[model samples]
Target: MKVIKKMSMTMALIAASATAAFASGQQAEEISYYEPGASIESIVVDAAGKGQVGNWGLGNEYEVQALLTKYGQPTTYLSQAFDMDGFDDDSILLASAMTYNELGLVKNSYDGGYSYGEGVSYIDMNDEGVAMLEDNLFTTAAFAAENPETVKAFIYASMKGWAYACENPEEAAEIVFNYGSSVSPEHQAYMAEQVKKLVETDTMGNMVRDYGKMDEAAMAQTLELAKTYIKLEDSVAASALEAMSLEDVMDASYWEMAMGSSGAFSPEKSEVSIQLKWLPQSQFMGYYVALDKGFYEEVGLSVNIIPGGGDIGETTAVYTGQVDFGVTWVSNLIAANAGGMGLLEVAQVYQRSGLVLVYKTN
Candidate 1:
């Protein structure tokens, strides 16, 4: 892994001073917006005609706003809920679900009918969710069995990219910050440190090399626990179990071919456009690479990377074919499949979950 050293003390101090100055009412000049006769829908259609995957390239911003509206509050509620001093488990779960939705990994009715007043709650991944998750995994594996080479290649590439991000925090942070408009400098630095800690301390290192590899034993154990602990509806069938296998669904070789030997996956070159949802940090690097380095052009892809503000529903986008692909957590994928979204796990970007339950010091 290539190490990018942190900012020097002098530079840090200068940045801090600058930030303080900005915070004290020395506001940055805002860009003027002249409304064009063209609507966002028209721009998106034109971009799509030219090979852009995401509609208007707006990405998760719309989803975030929608979620906030649904919650009857501002999106800042996430940061507030994360503060341990005012922690609310119920809020966290709803926030997590909302984030998952924005990432296009789950579906929810935003009719203002769902209760948001519940204090604290937990999605007991105890038995039922676990079983469902495992069932989906096996279904995926079974799909991959017919195309082992493809599955292996995709998994390998995904694992490689994920591992690289995990191993190099500063570099990754730089990539993300360059593209993520929502991430402030302080948050970027904090996220980088957090990712580093998670990767170094968790089981991500062990799973990195085994990118496409799935453990049958682990899958079985997970399934058993799911069945034993949770309530599964009668709708779940035995046939679904047979279809759920690690070997059934992954198609890494397809991605390998798509990416080519240069390791740049471009959707611009292809006549078909692919929608892409970028994980927070990964989204940054991906956008920078696509826009700055022209990786999208190189791969014959016109990519539109949507920013996730922890409130977009990526799974819904995929299900609706609004976007071709999205960056999301594994659990969302499980839920998506269960909900009958023909979504597949093309790659595992983060080896370990980045979701953390933070508490306030006060």
Candidate 2:
């Protein structure tokens, strides 16, 4: 049976070569392998055919699988955008690509960690990307202006998703695993339990139960922190930075909409859906819960979750009507706003950043 399989594969390769020749004037080729003491000419021909050098003996199923995995496709546009190495790593890149694709961008060759330019810092391009994002901020501003209530609902849903993940790590893990199958089931379960412990012990525990609620105080703290890191120039007032206090950013009217009150902000009357850009982790839960539990439907929303990574282009996503909401550090957002992206803070998810740069401690 094994011999038959090998013969069949060889025949298929020959047929493929013949077809290529017929279509594009290429030559037919064959792969050869040798045992110990084989002729040098035999070895050279074999190496050229397989696009490799030296003797690798016979091809196995593993080699075939590797070819399928490696040379299977091309890189995508979003893949080029997030430029994962420029941000963090492959995981972040995959997450970002998934988010943007979900939010309705043209699909391209997207594998997780494709590096484009070497030593191009994400922080340095902040001005260029943010300038583009600033132009797109008008879309978000218009949405906020027209459907303030739905915006609040979207925030409530986001906060609720975070709180749910904290309260039920197992559930969150299941959700994340559904989208990201790369994580082992055992690891997913372990992560869920750990996240639960982290949230329960934190000062924000109470807020998790209340829809991952962010109050004016929390928003104020976030804005203050943004002011510390963001280099805002003369065009945006230092007071504009200060005015970003929780009171200016948070409008609860949207939550009222989800509750079906007369005061609810209705985008249907205006015919619009909010575009939300999600951090890979945040969207994982939101999608699993919203799809599984129907949270989005309950609120009368058609939420479009945009994935981000590589040159993730968060500013571009927001400024171009790709996403109305995005998960970003205050530093990034403040930079975007300063670059004139007009990105406003609707809520703050993480009080302390999970981001850390680690090297060998020793």
Instruction: Give the least accurate 10-residue stretch of model 2, judged by summed lDDT.
Output: 128-137
Best by lDDT: 2
Model 1 ranges with Cα > 4 A deviation = 1-85, 88-168, 196-244, 247-291, 356-362
lDDT (Cα, tens digit) per residue for candidate 1, span 1-362: 01211333345456658788643432221111113443333332332232211211122122223323333433232333212221222222223222121211112123211222222222212111221221111114333434444333333333444455556656666666776545454445445555443333322224234333333443344334322322225356333433454433333444444334444432222322223333454333423434444444443444455554545666676567565455444444444454455556554333333332111111
Candidate 1 is scored at a TM of 0.46
Candidate 2, 15-118: lDDT as tens digits = 76768654332122221223445433343333334433211111101112222223332211122232333223211211121212211111222333232323
Per-prediction TM-score to the true structure, in the order listed: 0.46, 0.49
What C-alpha lDDT does candidate 2 achieve relative to the native structure?
0.40
Model 2, TM vs. native:
0.49
Error of 2 at 141 (Å): 3.5
Which parts of model 2 have CA positions greater than 4 angstroms off? 1-139, 180-208, 232-279, 282-284, 356-362
Please give the lDDT score for candidate 1.
0.36
